[model samples]
Target: MDIVISIASKIAESLVTPIGREFGYLIYYDTNMKDLKDELKQLFEMKDRVQESVKAAKRNGEVINYDVQSWQTSVDKLIQKVLHFEEEVSMKRRCLYRWNISRKATKITQDVLYLQKEGTFNNVAHPAPPPMIWSTFKEGFKDFKSRMTHVNRVTEVLKNEEVRMIGICGMGGCG
Candidate 1:
């Protein structure tokens, strides 16, 4: 029973982790895109309102009612802040996507290592399982190390890219 449970747990974990990671990536992408779209709609609506207010104030010989102008300015600033936040979230989502890829790669590499370690090649004597076992372990470790390094590199690249994108968007007021 203990052995059964242990095997069952490992199997379950192997199955669940990838699916969970994938689901998380999908959810982040979906939610961030939705938020971005909503923010865009809000920006447009704010612009339209600003135009209408200016037109009304102009027709009445006042470009803005002082009190209303203050409120509009505050709302505009808030909207700009929200757009910035959305951009941040989008950047995070991209990072999450990359992280997901790294995680899956690591998982596969580990699974191969696990199977090889469990004597999966014990029966084959023609090619000498000793070299196969040694090489597999060595290669698996190398892959693991490389994957970790790539994950860090990917994260840094993403951070820099996000900063550049934010700067560009801020300058254009198009976020």
Candidate 2:
């Protein structure tokens, strides 16, 4: 009986630690994409639920069943998916930033051409203008904040358990 209890305790520890570590990692991961972040947050909540269920099962000295294992496997797969999505988004954003910089450089060149055509600069020795890359990065941050705010509002509404149904009272043709 003592040996059985010891083995059960060991099993419980093994099961709980990996789930806890995964949960910790997921919570700590920084994601800029609002939808993906929200999905990770939801997964974190699910991890809590699974942890509780595991605890209850352990308290009863019951072996973890196949269904529980399957659920954990699914959660693990979801975490992997989220990580992959994050990497993909990050790469895309980097590409977008580079593209924006190139576009801005072209626009600046066009402005220079227009100024030359208009004879705006009388002096040929003029100081070079400061880079606009910082402004572009700031715009990206603003965009991210706007998206995060919208996602947060929607998440809050959906998470409110009391609000079972939502109605959109807007012009039908406008939508």
Say which candidate scores most in lDDT: 2
Q: Quote the positional error of residue 42 for candidate 2 in Å.
A: 1.6
- Candidates in order have lDDT scores of 0.50, 0.52
- Count of clashing residue pairs in every prediction: 1, 0
Query: Could you give candidate 1's per-residue lDDT for residues 43-71 as a string of tens digits?
Result: 45655655575665566554344544554
Per-prediction TM-score to the true structure, in the order listed: 0.30, 0.32
Clashing pairs in 1: 57-62
Top TM-score: which candidate number?
2
Task: Please identify model 1 stretches exceeding 4 Å from their true place.
Answer: 1-29, 86-91, 94-175
Report the poorest 10 consecutive residues by lDDT, candidate 2: 118-127
